[model samples]
Target: MADLSIDFVGIKSPNPFWLASAPPTDKAYNVERAFEAGWGGVVWKTLGEDPAAVNVSSRYSAIYDSYGEVSGFNNIELITDRSLEVNLREIEAVKKSWPDRALVVSLMVPCEEQAWKTIVKEVEKTGADGLELNFGCPHGMPERGMGAAVGQVPEYVEQVARWCKMYCKMPVIVKLTPNITDIRFPARAAKRGGADAVSLINTINSITGIDLDNMVARPIVDGKSTHGGYCGPAVKPIALSMTSEIARDPETMGLPISGIGGISNWRDAAEFISLGAGCVQVCTAAMIYGFRIVEEMKTGLANWMDSKGFETIEDFRGLAVPNTTDWKYLNMNYKVVASIDEDKCIGCGRCYIGCEDTSHQAIDLKPQADGTNKFEIIEEECVGCNLCQITCPVDDCITMERRDVGQPYMNWTQDPRNPHREVTEESTHEA
Candidate 1:
């Protein structure tokens, strides 16, 4: 069996799958159950001065597809509603019991140095493996100047991370909010503050949907609604892009990343790790399917690793980062044409309509002996955009085939079309 263990910023976990600091890790009961179900670690839900914070009923909303599956989720919930002392005691007990699994406490506090100093000391006494500063909660905490309010400002993120790093003895991981314009700024800020690693992204501020009948946003409480944090499968692309950005950024390169958002399966976990995430955190998937999902995640990842001849997670981790680059760095000379298998085409006309009306008119309609229209791609007109492949209902029926263009490597910067090019005799000869 391939070894699934990982040492993320010196915090070792049996695997890279940790429960995010959300309802799943809110208390010892859930954490204990999650550990039993094969999760490698848990970041205890964000804790603060608890007497002032309280949660409301009807705290969740979701967007469902035609099949009634949840594609996206929204939550108006706040952090740990239990008292500070109670949460600490539970965390201490859980850490004592689950000695092998990683237990990191998540904390949010008032924007004062002393407030952060006090909480860091209290959490350190719990013998937790590390601490995750919950600067990314997008909902209620911001109203009190705690969550996204602090996260949105790079200086505030840096200052608070510095405070935690100064006061806390354990490894500090700064959780970042995606609600900002440029994620790199905060990522760089966290690095400046001496954070051991960074976890992202918290949730996107969203209104899941509006109840047309009631004329209000979803998750209505007392017939009224408010914006909440949006997450789940729909956010995977956004999460992957941001993770890759930080991982590839020259300023934040080699900064360990704890990937979060829309990770529902082992494939998703592998994708995150390949894209420079040291470990991955899960919440919505567990909330939807339960902790046993970790079994599949572990098995699938281990099996895939074994097949790939990888002895450890580190071997494949960040392997894809180098391949991820800016648009300008893409191979402009490379070309691919879309190919449709006639035997597999169901004559759905989906690809034809999509290509003809919305995209390049590469697919042509042909009269068939059966009196049905057959779709074929025009080789000359096809740009290999793959819009037809994407719009096709059948899987593997349409695929992009790499064409041997036999052209030398060329890019916009070196192209003659670029008037601002720094032209030299050598460059002109190459062009």
Candidate 2:
């Protein structure tokens, strides 16, 4: 049997799926419901000192797909609007009742060492499993010089992380901001400051949409709007790329990652784990579908693990990292051409139009005897870009067939067309 449990940086959980700090984990009621619904843990919404954040009435908006589904979600909401005493009391009660589940308290405070020191001590008294330093909130908190403001500066990230570790006995996981140019810098700094692990990515800065009549960005408040953090299925690709970068980078290798951003299903969680994340966090999905979504996530992941002959999460975790390499190292001699299954073709000609107008003109349309159009791929001209296949209406109608060119494996560095080919010591000696 496959085991979904994980002990991330010594914080034990029933499974790897933990709820990221957000509205879903805002209070004891929500956290308790999430635990009852099968979530392994919850990173309690970011706790701050008194004078809590007062959010706007309209706090969220979403970008929708053609099918009217939410492709991306945006939020301008700040940290916990509740007072510190209220939040701390709830956190302690929840952790006490749910002793087996991981309860990590997400926290944000002023950059001052004393602020961090004081907050860490108070959170420790709650008997939570760990702390996720909330340095990733992009919109409201940054204006006060706390969230992305601290995350964007490597020195500040390190200094604050150090302060937390110095005063707190529990493990500290730094939640990183995605608004930076390079994620590795802050990740490396967190490690330098002795962080136990790191979680990402917070959210990409974005404006969901604009109301033409009002001329304001989405989730408008009193006829105005500000940029907010973006997440959901649309941001998954960006999140994956950033996660892989931190995983493979030598400076931050082996640092435990609690993957966040657009992780809706088990496959998304699997992808994050394969790229070196020890556990995965969900926020937008739970917000959209409610807590019961974790049931499908757990079932799907276990089924996948069993199919792969794996007994535990560790068996396949980080297994894909080595294969995720740079394009420069890719085999240039490998050839694949598009193959259209004529029998299954619906003659929609969507593939032909897509290829002709936007992509390579490799798909040719012809009037068939049955008075319908037949689309065929020009094998020689097809570069296997998969654009045509993606536009095809029928599933598996068009496939990329690998050509057995009998050519040896060659990368751009070894190719004759490369003007700036890498020169080895042997080449230097010959020259």
Candidate 3:
């Protein structure tokens, strides 16, 4: 089997699968179980000092898919409700017991130099592998001038990161919020402040659903609701896009990234790695399925790696970065239209109805003498869109077959039909 181990910014883990800083890593008890269940590392839940955060009794809501499975998760929960002293002691003990597993403490405190200096010194005493600046909590913490409040300001991120690096000897990783306008700003700030790595993307701000009866948002607290941090499968696309942007950004390029968001399996982890993530983190899956799920993620990833002849994570990591490009650089002349396979077609008119009703009317339905429905694509009318392919029920029944349009490759930047086309910064990617 291929090696699953990773050395991310000097923090070595048995594998790239680490538990994200969420409810799963709140205490020593939960962490020990995760390590035993084969997780390579964990970012302990965000911690604060003196007066702790007070959380509501009902703290969670979820969005379910048509089949009734949770596609998204929302939470108004704050930082660690437990005292700082107890969390520090447990972290010390957990590190001592699980020497091989990565234990990086996640922290959020008042945006004061002395406050950060004091906590950095104290957390270092526990012998943790590193520290993750909790600048991404989108809910309660922001109101106190922490979390997203600090993250939204690039200056604060750099300042606090520099403070930690000055006081603490361990590696510093900045956790960035997704609520900001552009992620690269804070990422570049972390780099300027000398952070060892960057982890993303913290949960997005969202309200999962509404309670019709109570006239409030879902996860109602006393017949009331407020927006919370959203995660789980639904946020995967957004997370992937953000991670790619940071990995490919000129200023922050080559900075180590720990990918988090909607990663439920080995395939999701692989995608993140291919996009230049040094490691991957999980929370929603563990919350929904328990710790044992790591067994499958570990074995599945290694097995796939072996089949692909990859000896280690580095063999395939960042393989997709170069191919990921801006829309203006895409090949405008490339063409592929849907092709219906008679062998695989189940006589389902889903594609026909979908395209005729909402998309280009490019498919024809014919009734065969054998008492079966035949759906065929109209070659002339097909505009090469994949709407029919998307609505098909059976896999491979509707395939997008490429055609030789006999046209030289041309991108949007050089196309004659573009009304506002010009050679500019975005066009520089064309070559």
TM-score of each: 0.97, 0.97, 0.97
Error of 1 at 69 (Å): 1.2
TM-score of 1: 0.97
Q: Model 2 lDDT vs. the true structure?
A: 0.92
TM-score of candidate 3 to 2 decimals: 0.97
Error at 258, model 3, angstroms: 0.2
lDDT-better candidate, 2 vs 3: 3
**lDDT (tens digit, per residue) of candidate 1 on 1-431:** 99999899889899999999999998888999999999999999999985848888899999987899888999999988899999999999998898889999999999999999999999999999999998898888899999999989999989988999999779999999999999999999999999999999999999999999989998999998899999999999999999999999999999999999999999999999999999999999999999999999999999999999999999999999988877654667779988999999999999999888988899899988989988888988998898999888899999999888898876655677778866454443322
Q: Relative to the true structure, how large is the alpha-carbon lDDT of every model?
A: 0.92, 0.92, 0.93
Candidate 3 colliding pairs, count: 0
* Model 3 misplaced stretches (Cα beyond 4 Å): 423-431
Winner by lDDT: 3
Clashing pairs in 2: none
Q: What lDDT score goes with residue 330 in model 3? A: 92
